[model samples]
Target: MVFRRKRKYREKIIKRSIWQQLPEESQNFFIETANILRFAGQFFVELVTPPYEHKEMIRQTYEIGYRTLALVSITGFILGLVLTLQSRPIMIAFGAESMLPSMVSISVIREVGPVITALICAGKIGSSIGAELGSMRVTEQIDAMDVSGTRPINYVVATRVIATTLMVPILVFYADALALLGSYVALNLNSEMTISLFLNKVLGSLGFMDVIPATIKTVFFGFAIGLIGTYKGYYSGRGTQGVGKAANTAVVTSSLIIFIIDLLAVQVSNLLMY
Candidate 1:
């Protein structure tokens, strides 16, 4: 009886301490952060212990990857073309026009391609997942799945996350290739450079360090986009407004996270290089 009373007292004190110490907004932020971390942890747990959703995963991959290809291709081509055109005058002015291929290749492969592609995916894929899941949540579809003993996290969230994680890297590679092709085209417009020589210069400028770190960062980018999107949607409130808010929040949050990840990746890459 005494121990029970003491425990109750301690719980009350702890609750009071939290409520008294933090502002309401800060409390909500902390609570939400904790919940997100828990959600991510749950994803990892469910990922390994699965009656795996292979079919759903494949469907998501096709949805996330193949469907996004045209957009990525156009954006990537424009990215490289614009970058080359913008840099050409500067290179010529410096009497280093011949080094343009190396400079552009390194810039695209090492940084620009991965970051820009990730931001695009965060806008497109992230918003889609958030809105879709938010709608499901608002419609009680997720609740119905729970009642039916269907693991929505595994079937819905896990599949999407895995698909993004796998596909974003592939997308980055595709974008990088397209960007180089666009650069080659831009280069030929101003001066004559054979495709063979351009390839040689681009390939020669890139090494293992340039490729591997960029590729690795895209995996994190994909994971962040998927995870944040699903989290926002899965826990969305009632009504259509909530669904819209979830989608908007997911895009904003995921974009911020992508930049954070890129910054950390750069720091780590620099450390490793040194």
Candidate 2:
């Protein structure tokens, strides 16, 4: 009986030791990942089932897309302008100044434009969605909607997600155009390139492959931003503090996701090109 008790105690200790080997952070990460996956699955399910919120979706699109134009415009213009100014001296030294339009257009279209635009949206739209939904959650407004037989997930989550997914690509395109225009302006500051000539060089440098891959990846960036923002906000803990945390986390997570997506997109684009 004594030996059996000792054996039982040893087994209990072994079990406890094994359990303790899994750190709390790791446990939380797994739990959070599972919840996010479940939330995403539910989003897809709700997205397909209808009682579609067309008005809400349209409102969200206007809010996300139109409201962000000024910020995107300024950032894109600066991006191209600075890139051109910085590259000009080097290009001149190498006697490659004439190739500036082609180089700038390819760089902006192939990588920088989509990534930078997505990051901007992630910071702006991601935080807004998180705070808005987090506030609703904290105020028990989401609960009220559920009690009233309104599916908050469908009305709120689906509309916002779809809006971001749709608007991000459009914003990227707009930003790219503005960026090229800015580059043209920069070129004219020291050179005599005509608009027609600049446009010709830019267009001539680009192919379907360059544009298509970049555009395709922006869609993923948008989806990730929206999905992450909604997830952070929807499942936020109660209280104003939680609302703040959700907004902050949403931005951080969405930005990280945008980079990851860009990395994968580059790899895929490279493979296709070869």
Candidate 3:
């Protein structure tokens, strides 16, 4: 009996040791990701069959889209300017300075503009949604809404999700435009080129294939960011501290999803382009 008890104790120690070796944070992340997928499905369901919140959605769209314009514009302009300036040395080295406009346009349209714009949105909007919802959840405001016959999920989550879905593309377009303008400015700083000449090269290089694929992927980026934010916020725990955690987690997770989606999109686009 004594030997058996010692064996059992050793087994228990082995089990505890093994469990400790496992990555708890990774396990929790998988669980959270699964929960977000479920929450995303629920959001779609609520969106399609709704006591539609038109007023709230419009409000959210304005908040997400209009309020974001200045920031997006500035970022895009700087991005284009910097990209142009950076690429200049390389192009000059290659004796391909003439290709600058097309090259910059292609890079901005196909990758940089959409990705950067989406990332910015994720950082700003994702954190806000998470903190707002997390606060409501922790303070029992969500509970109050439920008690009062208001579907908080539909009213809050759905509207924001839809707003994000619609707004991100617009932001991307604005970013692309501003980035191109910046590129043009950068080019003209070193050389005298007509606006018409620069635009012709830019317009010539961009095809349906590049523009369409880039735009399509941003929609997924927006959805992922919105869904993760809502999921983190709606289900946040640990009270006030959880709100901060949710915000931080929302930004991190949403950014990760954006990169993953962008990778898949690039693969798809390559296959289609080829």
Candidate 4:
């Protein structure tokens, strides 16, 4: 009995040490990620069912899209202009200013435009979704919906997710166009690259691989932002403080996940191509 007790105590010590060695932040991040995925899965299941809320979905789309155009357009233009100007000096040193249009176009289309647009959308939409749902949860509005026989998850999360998935791609398309125009303006600020010449160079370098992968990535970005926001807000429990915390965590976690997803997408794409 004494030997058995000693062995049991030793095993408990090893188990406790092993648990302590696990990074708390990493564990929390995975837990949060799994929760978001579960939310997204539930959303999709509800989304395909009937009693489709067309009007609500339309309203949500308008709210996400039209309201967000100005912010995305301005940021995209500035990103392109600044990226071009910054890259020009290095290209000039190499006597390769003629390569400016191609370089800027590829960079914008492949990564900059999509990633920046998503990050901006994450700040705008992610926090809003989190706060809205968090407020509902805190105020017992979701419970009220349940009492009223409304499926709150379907009514709320499904609309937001579908709206975001549809709207982000449109925003990305507009952003890419504006960014290219800004790049042209920046190029003319130094050298006289004609509009036709600038466009030709840009279009020549952009292939199906560049465009398709980048566009596909935006859908995942939208999904991540919507799901994370909804999950954080849906589970919030601490009143107004919970609302604030949900909003902050939604933005931070969604932003980090966006980058991670992008990295994984790149690796997967590389493997498929090679």
* Residue 221, candidate 2: alpha-carbon lDDT: 93
Superior by lDDT: candidate 1 or candidate 4: 1
Tens-place lDDT per residue, model 2, 84-140, is 999999999999999999999999999999999999999999999999999999999
Model 3 ranges with Cα > 4 A deviation: 1-22
Clashing pairs in 4: none
Cα error, residue 257 of model 4, in Å, equals: 0.9
* Residue range 1-274, candidate 1, lDDT tens digits: 9999999999999999978899989988888889989999999998997689999999999999977899999999999999999999999999999999999999999899999999999999999999999999999999999999988998889999999999999999999999999999999998899999999999998999999999999999999999999999999889999999999999999999999999999999999999
Model 1 is weakest, by summed lDDT over 10 consecutive residues, at 24-33
Which is the better candidate, 2 or 3, if ranked by lDDT? 2
Per-residue lDDT of 188-236 in model 4, one digit per residue for the tens? 8877878988899999999988899999999999988888888889888
**Model 3 quality (TM-score):** 0.90
For every candidate in turn, the CA RMSD to the true structure comes to: 3.3, 4.1, 5.0, 3.5
- Which stretch of 10 consecutive residues in model 4 shows the poorest summed lDDT? 29-38
Q: Tell me how many residue pairs clash in candidate 2.
A: 0
Off by over 4 Å in 4: 1-27
TM-scores for all candidates: the values are 0.92, 0.92, 0.90, 0.90
Clash list (residue pairs), candidate 2: none
**What's each prediction's clash count?**
0, 0, 0, 0
After superposing candidate 1 on the true structure, give the runs of residues whose Cα lies further than 4 Å from its correct spot: 1-25
Alpha carbon lDDT at 216, candidate 3: 95
* Model 2 TM-score on a 0 to 1 scale: 0.92
Please give the distance, in angstroms, between residue 223's alpha carbon in candidate 1 and its true position after superposition. Answer: 0.4
Candidates in order have lDDT scores of: 0.94, 0.95, 0.92, 0.89
